[model samples]
Target: MVDIRPDWQLLIDGGKKDSDGDGQRAVVNPATGEEVATVQEGTAADVDHAVEAARNAFEEWSDTSSEERARRLYAIADRIDDHFDELAEIATLENGKPKNQSGNDVFTAVETFRYYAGATDKFYGDVVENSKDELKLKVFEPYGVVGVVIPWNWPPMHTADFISVALATGNTVVLKPAPQTPMSSIRMVELMLDVLPDGAVNVVPGGVEPGVALTNHEDVDMVAFTGHDVTGEAVMKSAAENINPVMLELGGKNAAIVFDDADLEKAVSGAILNAFYNSGQSCASIERLLLHEDIFDDFLAAFLPAIEELNVGEGMDPNSQVGPIIDEAQYDKIQSAIDGAVDGGAEIAAKAESPTDEHLAGGHWVPPTVLTNVDPSMPIMNEEVFGPVLSVTSFRNDDDAVEIANDVEYGLTGGIWTSNLERAHRVAARLETGMVGVNRPSFVSLGLPFGGYKRSGIGRKRDLTETMREYVRVKSIQIDHTDARYSLDLDLAEQRTY
Candidate 1:
């Protein structure tokens, strides 16, 4: 196993390593309820130092050519690839995701950086043809400094989502990783320092104090945050103080709709994977599954058995498909939601058996739960469970399915399963979500724009071209091409009169 000691330090001004003045905090392992490591808690003062360092580095870094930036990004990606196994082990230990899933997270992060690196030369501004006598050029300039606050659910992958675009577009960054899973981010920054200039990438690991300080700082030009909606609102308010633009990826109550004519086995597998993946800690988890009345019974018969067969244990166990919840609070939330749903007349279709191992008695483990006869209005159906609990409800027809899927505050992701191409296209158009999967589950790709529609989020995340645009400011330059320098002759006389 990778070293689980607490010797990590904050990365400031790219290569400078320093200890936080605020005392240390323990990073707990949710799988075993033990302190995996200890990290220094960054305070408001540390945030100021980080921002100042980033601001100082912005002038030179932003002026560097896109080709050089791309080279540096590729180097970072290579470094990550070299240490992929160690990083994945750290992620699984801290984030409580299964080993394979954590490895996927690392691979995704590496690929994301490489994707942005390849697009460095392709993100170009436009030129408008307004008039023959004047030349109009649109240019994209990097924001001086950007603050990125990443959540713990997807540490390595989410950090890469913002950091790659920001650095590739020539913007310096001050990142604040979640306190729970700071080791991987710290290690990432450490590796990046070999190629990145000082202050080009800095990290402050802590809780609300550092996050608020970073968001409200005067020097930060923009903020990119991914977390719950409640905290997202606060980040927005803080950003508004300086009129700084903020990109938010908030919570979601995603749904998967299964039509009668769809492939039953495919739909069942998609729903199970979408619902229980990462123990349902993902924002795009399909907490609500709307099945057609004609196929509801058949869907459950297949879905329940699959969910029951899933293994739940420690993340390091190769056989474990589902791991423990992140912490006590998350475990309690999952329990409360499940109990509340059952109390509201929802029947439990399937629930996995808890591990009987004596060592796992104190772990924050929750079994995979599938609930049927769920009312669409129930809190478990409408609210984001953020756990391995899938609530199934029946819809009469296509219109009913659309209505049920769209009747929620979140519009992040939805799935449509059907054999009829026309019906799939029609229903996909009606579902109010940022992304829809026709025959499969919703997933992120290199070039696709990923974000939510309604209260789910504020801006997009993926797509190298689109993401680079968000971190930069656009400027339109107009030049007078004509040789004639005709100032109105009458203007002299009019100026004297005025």
Candidate 2:
């Protein structure tokens, strides 16, 4: 059993501090609607301190050898693995995700760090041959400091995603986690400091004040954010004032296309998982389901039963397959979306009954919901529900499927389920999403770049090589081997002759 703390302090420069006397906010567990912990609510002053510390540490940290950086990253990964259960418990308690899912989040984080650790020595710049007398080289260098803002849904995983790559590329970071779920991130940064130098990683837990300060700070060279689209746009706007580069992984209204030739069982199972995982809080969650006309009925026959069978209760329970929403605001948003869909003439194809357990009565729970006859213009179809609500529509052909899938403003992730190899490639080529799973519901690995295309987001993450490129600036150097006076004289003579 892990010890639940009543209060946690902010981490800055390898030590804990109060939030500049700004006081604290209660961190509630959605599973029980109880205050699991209280964390310092950092202010703009705290943000300034964190950024200054990171800026001060950047020089020495960036100057470290790549091999040494790799060793430290590996050490951090090992420590995460050593304390996996403890971290997972904290994650579940604060984020309201299942114990098993939290464990997987930590596991993915460890692997992500390890993956970037190996790339430390493999990342290289280019040396091109321009002329015999001169040599041209392109060298990569780290941006002095990075400001990272992570969402509450996937705190540890997203935290690791940005910090690991930023640190691996020799960029110090000042991270601001979502106010609702800050303890897990605080603890993760604390563990990271054991291997990293002071100020290499700092955490300022707050709502919007610290984020605004971090993005608009003159010393912060770049900003990486993962959250709602509106907040992401605000972050971009603030960073633009200082001409800082911003990497955003914003909201997604993803779709899944199922063809007649697809495996019914596989498609149904994958679709259910895609729609309901993390209680459907993922940015890449499949909120829209596009089914071919021929397979719509068959798909629903197998899909409804599975969605109905999903168990929803406390995340800590070993038997619970789905957990409560992150907070009351999110729960209300999801409920409103469902009500709006029903009022818009959409039919509820399948909806899981609320849990009967008396202990879970106060929790913010939304059963796995599936809607059919959903029009493309419905808000549930166009907007991001960010819940276990799936809005389904049918397509008569490939063209119709493509049109429906690309109808939304978001192009983050999509799924294509088909047995026809030619059809799969052709359809995938036409889909506007940044990432597509051909036969699988989700396809995310360490090496592949994960990001969105349209309004969903800007830039990518996950791939070590690509992530490093984003965190660094390039400089082109040319060495002149020929005598400058002789060259100038020759040029003048040639000009006179002309």
**For this target, which candidate reaches the highest lDDT against the unseen true structure?**
2
Error of 2 at 4 (Å): 2.0
Q: On residues 243-305, what C-alpha lDDT tens digit does candidate 2 reach at each position?
A: 999999998899999999998888988988888989999998999999988878888888998
TM-score of each: 0.96, 0.97
| RMSD (Å) of each candidate, 1 decimal | 3.2, 2.0
What tens digits encode model 1's per-residue C-alpha lDDT throughout 272-300? 88889999999988988888999888888
Which 10 successive residues of model 2 have the least lDDT summed? 485-494
lDDT, residue 87, model 1: 95
Q: Which clashing pairs does model 2 show?
A: none
Poorly placed runs, candidate 1 (over 4 Å): 130-132, 485-498
lDDT for each candidate structure: 0.89, 0.89
